[model samples]
Each structure stands twice: as structure tokens, then as C-alpha cells.
Target: TIPACNANYLPEGISEHCPIKVTFVEEGLNTNKLFQFCNVWAKHPLFIDKVQAAWVKLLMVLLKKELKVLNTQFFRNVVAEANDDRMALYLAQNKLQADPMNMTLQRRREGEILEVQKYIIYGRDVLTT
Candidate 1:
């Protein structure tokens, strides 16, 4: 979307309308290229302004279109499930500390600690070693 430094209209060959040729120069390099873009892009809210401001700094879109899907997956897989394991591990550690002989609390602590460790290994936002 760089600004065109030169423009010319060529004589119509087969079509009724003349073809517009635009030239762009960047840092001493010159180019004459034809750009083909999707019509849907023209419908964007900032279409006109984005084109005009391209010379200032070219910036574009990201995952803004489907953020809702990502939010659900991230919360369910990384945040909510990891928090559940953390809470269970915490309870198991406290109960085991009170009655060190209890086999049930010992087993629970082992299982929950493994689950929390899996989250840690996967690089999730959980308490680290």
C-alpha cells in the first residue's frame, strides 16, 4: 500500500476504459506493479483510512476476526483445568501434612501433583518448581 510516485493512463486496447499504470519508488528502488485485491477488503471499516496512512507505517489485521473461539479453548484447556488441579493439589498437601500416615491423602497428592506437573510442562501459567 505504498504511495504511487507516478501515474499514467494508457490507451484502451480491447476494453473501453484506459488502464492506469502507477509507479512506486522506495529508497531509490523503482517498481511498476499491478495490484489485485479482494473486493471484500473495500468493505472494511478502516479501508480508506488504512490506504491513506500506508506511507506513515504499514500495519494490518490479526486474529481479531475469530477471538471468541480462541478465548473458549484457552480458558478451558489452559486456565480452568490447570486451576482445578492446583486447588486439588493444595488440599491434598494440607491433608497429608496433618495425617502423614493416611494412605488416601498420599495417593491423592501424588495424582494431583502429576496433573499440575503436566500443566507446568506444557508451559501453562501455573505455579512452577
Candidate 2:
């Protein structure tokens, strides 16, 4: 016999060593179950409306989760690129100071350094537009 379930709980098993009890499945790949609505419930006028409301709520929750993942990735990539550029310029400047005549460090023009700084300081705000 199937036990009662709510929004976040599902009955999994019962203890066999002593008094029989129901253990709910809190997490696992196959823990989520399907919605089972009896056809007889259609006789109620509010049944359809209730189902629609439930489905809409579920869709909203799923959409929010997806948006969170996308936002996290966007921030991660944007910030990582910005940090990389800043680190590159800083490292080159440090090396140039150590070896004042290094040709590679001298190749990094002042304009290029300014461009990198501008991108990190201002271009990162491009997401607002």
C-alpha cells in the first residue's frame, strides 16, 4: 500500500528489526514520483483549476532554478576573464620592473595596458545595457 506524501517527503521503507515504521526517501536519482490523479476527481468543478495552479507553480520553480544556474555561470565567466586580463598586465609590469630592458615587457604598449584596465573597470558593466 502506498503511504501518504506531501510536497517534500516520500515513504521509502519500514524498519524490520523492531516496530515497523516508514522511512521517507529524502534524496536519490529515482526519488521523484509522478502525479497520480484519479479520473473520478474530475467530477469536482475546482479540480481543473487546482491542477492548473499546481502546474504553474511547478513551472515557476523550475524556471527559477534554471535562471540561477545561468546567472552563476555568467558571473563566473565574466569575472574570470576580467581577473585574467588584470593579472596579465600586472605580471608584465612586475617582470619589466625586475628586468628593465626585457623586450617582451616593452612590447606591451601603454595604450594596450589602458585598454585592459578600461575593460575591467567599465566594460564589465556592459551587462546592464
Candidate 3:
């Protein structure tokens, strides 16, 4: 059976002093039996919502982790995969341009070069009036 959930969490932007509690519970202990039982619940409508909610929660956690790793090449690959080369380049240029001022990330030499290259590429070099 799919586990039922009850939530009484307060709405966002209401209180700054209130503490929140989160809990996860698994009812049965038999691993093989539980797998079979969960399989049946997968086709149920109520269980589908629960499963999707859990998946969304999992994705949120994964996204948070990905955002934390700024210098990872895998993240750069993922960003490139999500956008075309031109768009990705534009985004990288914009980020690199602003990175020196953002307190969250320490500026790098490559970032400064990107900023200068973007300026030279797009700045007032030609006339089109």
C-alpha cells in the first residue's frame, strides 16, 4: 500500500521564527514483499501522484547539488547540452562578465578573459544606422 501523507506546514513568507519538521517513514520490513506491493501501487492513480511528488522532491535535491558545483566540467556540459552553442556562449559570457561582482563565486582568469572577449565581440566596433 502507498503511504498516506499529512502536511501542516506553514505558507511561505509568513513567519521567520517558526521551525519546520520533515519526516519519512517506511511501514513494512520485508524487502521482497515490499517491492511486489509497491509494484501494484505504481498503477494506482493515488500512488501515481505520490510517486511523482517524490520524484519532484528528488529532482529538487539534485538541482540544488548541481547548482552548488560551479567549477565542475559536468555542469558546464549539462549547460551546453541544454542550450545551443551560441546561446551557451552568450550565457557564459554574461555570467563571466558579472562574476567579478558576485560575492558567491570567486572570479577566475578565464572569466575575465571571457568578459573582455564578449565586450570586444559585441561592443561599438561597427556602425549600423
TM-score of each: 0.41, 0.33, 0.26
Judged by lDDT, which candidate is best?
Answer: 1
If both were scored by lDDT, which would come out higher, candidate 1 or candidate 3? 1
Off by over 4 Å in 3: 1-36, 71-129
Query: Over the full model, what C-alpha lDDT does candidate 2 score relative to the true structure?
Result: 0.58
In the predicted model 1, the residue pairs found to clash are none
Which is the better candidate, 1 or 3, if ranked by TM-score? 1
- What is candidate 1's lDDT per residue for 1-129, written digit by digit as tens? 666477776533222355688786555656768998999999999999888888445333344335536756665535566767777776777687689899998788788878877866887555432
Predicted candidate 2 versus true structure: per-residue lDDT over 7-62, tens digit per residue: 43221111112223456554546666899978989989999899999999999999
For residue 121, give model 2's deviation from the true position in Å. Answer: 7.7
How far residue 55's Cα lies from its native spot in candidate 2, in Å, is: 30
Clashing pairs in 3: none
